[model samples]
Each structure stands twice: as structure tokens, then as C-alpha cells.
Target: MSTVFVVGSLNIDQNIRVRSLPRAGETVRGSDATFSPGGKGGNQAVAAARAGATVKFTGAVGDDAHGRRILEVLSEASIDAGHVRVSGTAATGTAVIAVDDHGENQIIVSPGANSGITAADVDAGLAAVQAGDVLVLQLEIPTALVRQAARTAKGRGAFVILNAAPAPRQIDGLLDDVDLLVVNEQEIQVLAGLAGMPGNHRDLVQALPPALGPAIVCTAGAEGSFTVLDGSLVHVPAATVAARDTTGAGDTFVGYLAASLAGSHRDLPAAMIHATRASAIAVTRTGAMESIPWAHEIPASAPKPATPDPATPNTASPNTALSSPVVPN
Candidate 1:
């Protein structure tokens, strides 16, 4: 199995359950609050570990109690956290999350130490990257550092998966280093304005200019997800389940997907199916890292060998590609 490398943010997530999301200028009542280790990077690292992958993590946190807790969680998951940094000047990152009874959530994040990652840190974290390895990145950290890591990994023959969370306004040159682009419906909508040349979401993806590189996956919540293969759109359905809190579902899916892809036991399509099951299980639970399911909990899809996703296109343009790891593509 290939080693999976993850570089992103780490945070202490404060979760509160409410009846419904409060609109702007509104206040609502909720259930008791809970705090746990989260951050897309940490959550996905745990998810990959739970899904049977050997993982290495690179992230930043403060030299505080929350940071210690993050380390403890990583230790428990058996992830290689040697590259994790304890920032000297910043407090640990934090996220205030509100999950409605329907399982939808809104989050406000204070970058804090998550914004403390340095170029040297990224280099050290990926020092051992080798061909056939899997490199996963999220937008929680500095984009330049991520771009450097992606380019470095690509040069070393590593397969790169970029989860563009908190989706950036423009991805032009960044996509050049990534093999796969992942995004959610809302994030995809951000790019819709650029492509100004579209119909529905599917058409939007299919019509994406080749300059944006190949392989874009879009997760559309309950509606499932879709990806472009051979320039044609392929859809994958979601597993049926009653969601409790959807907090870490996307992280779970990304982690499992990266692991499955690195495992070489199946192609991206089959791995997407496997990953979807894992995320479905996560939504039925609560919290972020606490919500990710173990490998045994998900039924792995049968092997369906096929070509890898990053083979067709080359450049990444705002006028082109995307996909979030949650649903299908």
C-alpha cells in the first residue's frame, strides 16, 4: 500500500446542536455544546487511518491545551505526526460549529495556528515522498505552501488530491500540480460565474475547459456526486441513511477515498463507492473526527480496475474542473 501524506489545518471544534440554522441577525436555542479535535487535515488523517491506510500528517497547532489534545488524537490514530508543529506565537485554531437537527451545519473558523505553517514545514513533511504515494491537501493552510508541496509531490511521482474547501476564488495555476480536484456544491457554485458558459451543473462540469486539468468530482449532498471520465460525466449515488450531524463527513470521505486509491485495490470509481459508504456512516454519527467510521464498518466495493483519473488534461483553469470528496466523484 502507498503511504498517504496529508497537509492542512488542525483545530478544536466546538459543536452545538440547534433546531435550525439561525438566519443573519437571529438567535436560536440549542443543545449542550461539545468540543473535540477536528480541522479538515486532522479529520481526514484520522479517516485514512481508520480506513486502513498508513498515514503521515503535516499541520500546525498552538502550544496550548488544544494543541496537546490534537496531538493526543493523532497519537491514538497511529498517524505519523512528526511533522506537526507547535506554533510559538499563535493559539491553537478553533471552529464554532452549529449543526441543525436536519444535520446541516455552519461553521466559523479562526485560522489561528493553522495559518502558521511554513514552507520549510511543508518540505520536511514530504521529505520522504516517493513515486506512487498519495498526497492529500486542503485549503485550511497557506495556498502557496500547498502549491509547493503539490508540485514537489508531483515531481516525485506522487498522486495529488486537492480538497478545495472554503473554495478559493481562483484556482488557475494551483491546479497544475494536482491530479484531482474536489469540491462541494456550494464551492462549485463559486466557480460557476467564471465558466459563464454553462447549462446545469453536469453541463458545467462537462464543459469545463481542458486547461483546468483532468478529473473533477462534485459532491451534491443527498443528491450524490458526479465526475468527468473520458470527457463524459459519470454519476455516483449516495448511500441511504438518516444523518445526525454532518460535520466530519467530507473529511471522512476524502480520507477513505485517498486510502482506497492508494491501496490500488480498485479504481477511482470503485473507490468513490467505497468512500461514499464511509461518509454515509459518518453522517449518522456526530462531531468531526469522532464521526469518521472504521474500515470494518464500511463494506468495500468490489475491485473495478480502470485508468487513473489524472491522465487526460494538463493545465488547471478557473474556466474548468472540480469535485468534493464527500459524495461520488
Candidate 2:
């Protein structure tokens, strides 16, 4: 098994369920509220660990109770936290999430200590990475730091997988350095600038630049996933399940995808099938990290993989559709 290193943010998620989201200047009563450990980095780290990956986490947290609790949560998930740092000047990062009746979510984040993750932090943590290891990253932390980590990881002969979530505008240069880029429908549109792209497997694959990386995976919630590998495109449909909350589905998908890729199964299509199955299980529950399924808890048989569309055309354009709206938590 290959080790997975995640360099990102750690946040305490404060979640509230309500009948519907309130309009500006309008007030609505929420049904209930709960707090859980969450952050793109932390969530993916936990998800990867639960899916049987040897995972290490590197990020910053505040010297507060939330920070301590976050560490405890990561420890419980068996994620190595030797690279985590605590800062006295800042409070722990927090995300205020509002979920409506339709399993939709809205989120507002306070960066706090997560923004403090520096270049030096990534450099010091590079000692744990080795050849064949997988280094996963997101846009939650500073872009400069992510770039530095990618460069370092690549130099060490490790595969770099970047989940460009919370999409950043300055990600074009970083794509060339990444080994894999996992994104969603909105992200693809933003990167390709193509509108009404049919959300098809081939269309999504043809959208990305081939020289940027060896593979590109585009996740479409409920509709399933699309992947482009070795100049070929494959579409994997999502498993059907009663969704209670869609808060961490994407994170679950990416995390499990990373784990599967690191494991004995190097087949990208098969790994994505497992990832989609894991994410389907995630949407049936509530909360972010709490919803990610453990390896033992996954279904005995995964979903049947979908064949790529042979007749699909290559419609690559610069005028892209609006990015997919994130599910409110």
C-alpha cells in the first residue's frame, strides 16, 4: 500500500438543519444544530484513512479546545498527525453550515488557523513522503503553499493528486505539476470555459488539456462520474441511495479514490467505481467527516461500472457554464 500525505486545513464544522435557507435580511428558525470535525483537508484525510490508506496529515489549528478535539478525531481515524501544528495567536478554523430539507447545504467558513499553514510547514512534512506515495491537496490552504508542496512531492517521485475544491482562480499553473486532478461539473466548466457541456463522460474528459496530467476525473453528483485516462474517457454512474445529507459526498469520493489508487488496484476505472460506491454511502448520512464510510462498513458488492460512450464528440470550448453550486450542509 502507498502512503497518502494530505496537506491542508482543519476546521470544526458547526452544522444547523433548517426547513429552508433564508433570504438576505430574512430570518428562519433552524431545526437543530451539531458540531463535527471538518475541513476539506481533514475530511479527505479521514475518508482516505477509513478506506484503508496509510494517511498522514499536515495542517495548522488553534491552541483551543476545538483544535484539541480535531486532533482527537484524527487520531481516532488512525491518521498520522505528527506534522500538525498549533498556533497560539489564532482560533481554530470553523465552518458554519446550513442544511435544508432537500439535503442541500450552504456553508460559510472562517479560515482562522488554517490560513496559517505556511511553506515551511509543507517542507518539514516532506520527509514522510517517499517514492510511489500519494500526496493529496486542496485549495483550502494558501495557493502558494499548495504549489510548493506539489513541487516538493513531485521531486520526490511521489504522485500528486489535487482536489481543486472551493475552486481558486489561479490554478492553471498548478495543473501541470499535478499527477491527477479530481474536480466536479462546475470545476470542469470553470477550467474549460464550456457551457451546457451535456455533463457527459466524454465531453468532460475532452475538456481538459491532455498535457496537464495523465488523468482527469470529473464528479457529477447523483449523475455519477467521468474520467479521461490515456486519451480514453470512462463514465462511472453513482450508486442509488436515499440521500439524507450531501455534505461530504465529494470529499468521500476523492478520499476513497486516492486510497483505491494507492492500494494494489492501479486500475483507474475500477478504483473510481469503488470511490463512487463509497460516496453513495456517504450521502445517506448526516455530517461531513462523520458520514464517510469505513472499509469494513462498505457494501459487499460495488456498483456496476458504466461503459464509456463511443459516439460522443469532442466539444472543448473556453466559454464554460456556471460552476455547480455546492450542497449546503
Candidate 3:
């Protein structure tokens, strides 16, 4: 199995179950308050590890009990935490989340130690990417380090997959070196200016362009995902499932998608299908890393098309080996 480098954040998630979400300035009573491992980067790292990829994680966590717990979770998943930093500057990152009976959620993040990642740390974390490897990144860290990571990882010949969660305020030239840009319905609209109207993924497919010259993936829950790659647009519909907790579903999809593409013969479309299935499984459970599906849980892929999609790899899947340039971290 190829190695996956996940350079992102690690957070202790505080989860509360509520009958209904609170409105602006309204207080609501919630039951079943719990704490668990979380953060986009941490969740994705676990997801990749479960998907059968050897994962190495790099991020900062406070020298505290929450930080230790986060590391334990990563270790339990068999991911390498050697590159993770124990920081004294700030406490471990945290997220306050409220999940309603309907499984919808409201979240507030406190970056904390996640903000301590620097360029030097990025270099140290990505040193082993010289060989064809998979580098998964997210926006939980600082943008400067994110850009540096993209450039450095690209220079080292690793394929870069960027999940632009919590869309940034400024996107100027940030995607210059990205190979694949992954975003959700609202994120795509904010980043690519392509508003994929709810329940209509066709609009995103039609409006997509290789603007930064990298493939783009926009995921819309239940409505499915749309992708533009190798001069073609492909739509992979999602499986319909009643969600119990939708938190971390996107991370599951991203982690599995990266794992399927990295060092595997699966094509982009096939990998997307695989990821979609993994995410469907995640929604049936609660928690972040805890909810991700394992490789065994993923079913065997469907037979290849008589004529494969152009985006599908002929030699190596793009995820298997990205040629320099990467999506933002």
C-alpha cells in the first residue's frame, strides 16, 4: 500500500444532542453531551488508515489530555503520529457541535494549537513524499503553511488532494499549485463561484472549468458528486440513506477517495463511487473518526465500462500519482 501524508488539524470534539437546533440568539437544551476525536485532517487520516492506506499525520496539539487522546485514536487506527507536534503555545483545537434529532448539525471551531503549524513543520511532515505518495490536506491549518505544503509536496512528486472546508475569505492565487480541488455544495460556490443549486449537480458540472488547471470535485449530499477532469465531466450519484449524524461524512468520502486512488488501479469515477459508498456508511453512525468506514465495509467495485471515462487512468490513477501541482491544503 502507498503511504498517505495527512497534514492537518487534530481537535477534541464536544458533541451535544439536541431535540432541535437553536436559532440566532436562542438557547436550547441539549442532552447526551460527549467528547470525541475530530478535526477534518484527523478524521480524514483515520479514514485513510481504515481504507487500507498507511497514513502519516502531521499537526499540532496542546500538551494536554485531549491531545493525548487524539494521538491515541490515531495510533489505534495504525496511523503514524511521529510528525505530530506537542505544542505548549496553545491548547488542542476544539469544536463545539450540536446535532439535532434530524441529524442536521451546527458547529463552532476554536483553532487553538491548530494555528501553530508553520512552514518548517510542513517541510518536516512531508519529507517522505519523494516517492509517489498521497498527500491529503484541509483548511484547518494556516493558509501560508497550506500553500507551502502544496508547493513542497508537489515538488516531491506526491499527489495532493485538498479539501477546502470552511471556505477561506481570500482565494487569490492559492490554488495555483493544486492538482485536485475537493469542495462541497456551498464551498464550490464560494471558491469556484459555481453555485450548485441544492438538489441539482448538473449546474456545477456545466459551470466547472480547469480555471486553475486542476480537476475539481464538488460533493452534494444525496444529490451526488460532480467532477471535471481530463477535459470531461462525470457525475456519480450518491446512495440514499437515512442519516443519523452527518458530521464527518465528507471527511470519510475524501479519505476513502484518496485511498482508492493512491496506489490502486481504481479510476477516478470508480474511486468516487467507492468514496460515496463509504460516506453513506458514515452517516449512519455518529462521531468523526469513529464514524469512518473500513476497507472491508466497502463493497467490491462494479465492472469497468466497455469504454472507460477519459478521466479514468490509463496507466496510473491521478490519485495514485499526481505530477507536481496540488490542490490547496
Candidate 4:
């Protein structure tokens, strides 16, 4: 199996469960609070590892207890953390999250040490990357470092997959070096500056700059996902499920998608199918990494032919048809 290099952020998520989100100044009583290991980069790396990919993580953590715990968690997930660094001046990244009774969440992040990643960090991480390996990235870290990693991975002939989350106004010139740009509906709108109205998959795909890359994947939540690759438009429907916590669902999809691509199956459509299935499973549980299901844990049988039951959500589905709007969890 090909190895996956993940260069991104590591954060400790402090989550609170409440009856509902607070309004302007109205404070609501929270039911409980829990802390978990999270961050786009770390979550995706764990997701990829659980999906059966040999994964390596390259990011910065603080010289604090949270940082130590981050490394410990990654080790438990069997992810290679040899390239992870410790920042003396900064604290580990953190996210404050609020989850309501409906499983909806509101999150605020502090980059902290994750923001300290530099080009040097990317260079150090590249030591283990090889041709045909998969290099996955996200925008949570410094954009310069993200570009450096993508360029380096591309130079090494490794497939570069970029999950442009927490989308920025400008991504420098990194897209040209990226092999796949995985983003969701809101992100696409932010990058493209299109009207607030929903758009057709083809229309959305056409809006992207032709010079960026050949493939653009737009993920729509329950509706499904859309992919434009090699001049072909493919829509992959999502496995219907009663979502518990949507956090990390997109990371799960991206992780599983990267793993499927790095593995023997090079077909993009098949990879998307597998990723969608994995993400569906993630939504049925709570927490980020804790929600991700292992490869063996996925149901062996395919989904039933009937329309998905909203009440009883199952991630494992049999249908392979690609259809639906792009919604990133």
C-alpha cells in the first residue's frame, strides 16, 4: 500500500453539549462538556489510518500537555508522528465547540502552534514521501507551508490531494500543483464568488479556473457529492443517515478518499463511493476521531435498494450511482 503524508494542524477540541446554541447575549445552560483530540489534519490522518493507509503526520504542537496528548493519540491510531514538531513559544491549537440536542455544532478555532508551521517543516516532512505516495493537505496551517508541501509532493511524483477547508480568500498559486481540490459547497462559493443561489454541478465546475487542475470535487452534505475530472462530470450520492455530530465528516470523507486513491483502486468514482460510505458512518456517532469507523468495521453488505431511511441511518450502502448536490459536513 502507498503511504499518505498529512501536513496540517493538531488541536484539542473542547466540546459542550447544550439544549441549544446561545443567542446574541442570552446564555443557555449547557448539559455537559468533553475534550477530545481533533484538528483537520489530525482528524484526516486518523481517518486515513483507520481506513487502512500507512499515514504520516507533519504539523506543530506546543510544549504543553495538550501537545503531548495529541502525539499520544496519534500514536494510538498508528499514525507516524516522527515529523511532528514542538513549538516553545506557542501553545497547542484548540477548538471550542458547541453541540445542540440535534447534533448540530458551532466551532471556533485558535491556530496557536499550528500557525507556526513553516516551509522548513514541510521540507522535513518530505523526507518520507516517495513517488506514487499520497500527500493530503488542508488550509488550517500556514498557506506558504501548504504550498511548499504540495509543490514538493508534486515534484516527487506523488499525488497531491488538497482539502481546502476554512477556505481563504486567496490560496497563493498552490492549486496548480494540486492533483485534487476537495472542497464543499460553501467553500466553492467562497472561492468562486458566485451568487448565493445553488448551482448545477457543471456550472460550478466551469466556474473554477482552468489552470488550477483537472479535477474539482464539490461535496454536498445529505444531497451527495459532485466531481469534475478529465472533462467528465460525476455525481456521487451520499449514504443517507441520521447525523449525530457532523464534525469531522468532511475530514473522514477526504481521508477515506485519499486512502482509496492511494490503494489499489485508482478509479476516482470508486474512491468517492468508498469515502461517502465512510463519512456516512462517521455521522451516526459523536465526536471527531472517536466517530470514525475502521475499514473492517464498515458493514460488509451493501445498502438496500430502497430509498434511505432517515430514522435509521446506515453508512454502508451498495449502490454505486453518482448523483446529488455538493454539501460538505
Work out candidate 4's RMSD over C-alphas. 6.7
Minimal lDDT window, size 10, model 2:
320-329
**Residue range 1-329, candidate 4, lDDT tens digits:** 78989999999889888888888898988857788889999999999999999999999999999899889989988999988989999999999888888777888999999988878878988887788798999999888888889889888878888898988777558686887788888787776653343455445654463534435778988768766533345567778788888888999999998888888767777677888889999989888878888999876654332232343223222122122211111
Better of 3 and 4 by lDDT: 4
TM-score of 1: 0.89
What TM-scores do the predictions have?
0.89, 0.90, 0.88, 0.87
- Over 155-220, each residue of candidate 2 has an lDDT whose tens digit, in order, gives 887878889888767555676568777888777766654333344444656655443443578898
* Count of clashes in candidate 1: 10
* lDDT by residue (tens digit), candidate 3, 23-43: 999999998789999999999
| Candidate 1 wrongly placed segments (more than 4 Å) | 300-329
Cα RMSDs, all models: 5.2, 6.0, 4.9, 6.7
**Residue pairs whose backbone atoms clash in candidate 3:** 177-326, 178-326, 178-327, 179-326, 179-327
Candidate 4 error regions (>4 Å): 23-26, 194-202, 209-211, 302-329
lDDT of 4: 0.80
TM-score of 4: 0.87
Span of ten consecutive residues with least summed lDDT in model 1: 319-328
